[model samples]
Target: MRTDMPAEIWLDPYRWEALQEILEQDGTDIEEVLQNYLIEVYSDRVPIERQKEVDRRIKKERLAAVQEAEARKVFCAMHIREHGQEYILMEKNGREFLQVAVFLRRYLRNEFTTPPQRVRPGI
Candidate 1:
């Protein structure tokens, strides 16, 4: 991961202070500490209902990502049928569209042989 801090941390004094405190803790995992601190502090900013909605959206997005990855693998397999392996391996345009197409093709074929596992929200 990149070492750069987000602009929000620089803009918020309290957040910066909390970050500094996390950094100052000796022999501890700084990243884990900072993550927990940020989650505890920032999650309070939103209403409970809004947070639930956000959590739901995040879960949906993660599910979509997993589906997309699976579709990409299947799409590559199909593309390899006509265009050869290089077509899937080579850098090319329309990759995102291709993934979607592959997903649709699989759906139409009723070939959901191995569906991606759903991830729990707010992990």
Candidate 2:
């Protein structure tokens, strides 16, 4: 259940040279080379169940990112409709405009809760 995972690896000069040599060998594609390297490097450190969990989490994150991107697109379109394309472009280039934009965007999308009205007696 580790949330912080390393996305990349750094290989020293000698190992990198060896990897390049392997890549240059006949009929060896990058996918095969990397797969072999991963097996050699992490085969013992990670179990099959852990690898499956990591893959699942990666997929879930990717799907969430796509959904968030779609939602942002919808919010942007709503903003443009409410305040024209020219105004949107003008605000887009301004410093700290994103803070305002996010507030307006969420408001336009009805993502914020409406405040309760104060009651005046016998209105």
On lDDT, the leading prediction is 2
Per-model CA lDDT versus the true structure: 0.57, 0.59
**Model 1, total clashes:** 0
Instruction: Name the regions of candidate 2 deviating beyond 4 angstroms.
Output: 1-22, 25-35, 39-45, 74-123
Candidate 1, residues 5-96, lDDT tens digits: the string is 55332337687667667777764554566678888976888788989997788788888888987667632222222322121222223457
Task: Give all TM-scores, in the order shown.
Answer: 0.39, 0.36
Candidate 1 segments exceeding 4 Å error: 1-27, 75-123
Q: What's the count of clashing pairs in each model shown? A: 0, 0
**Clash pairs of candidate 2?**
none
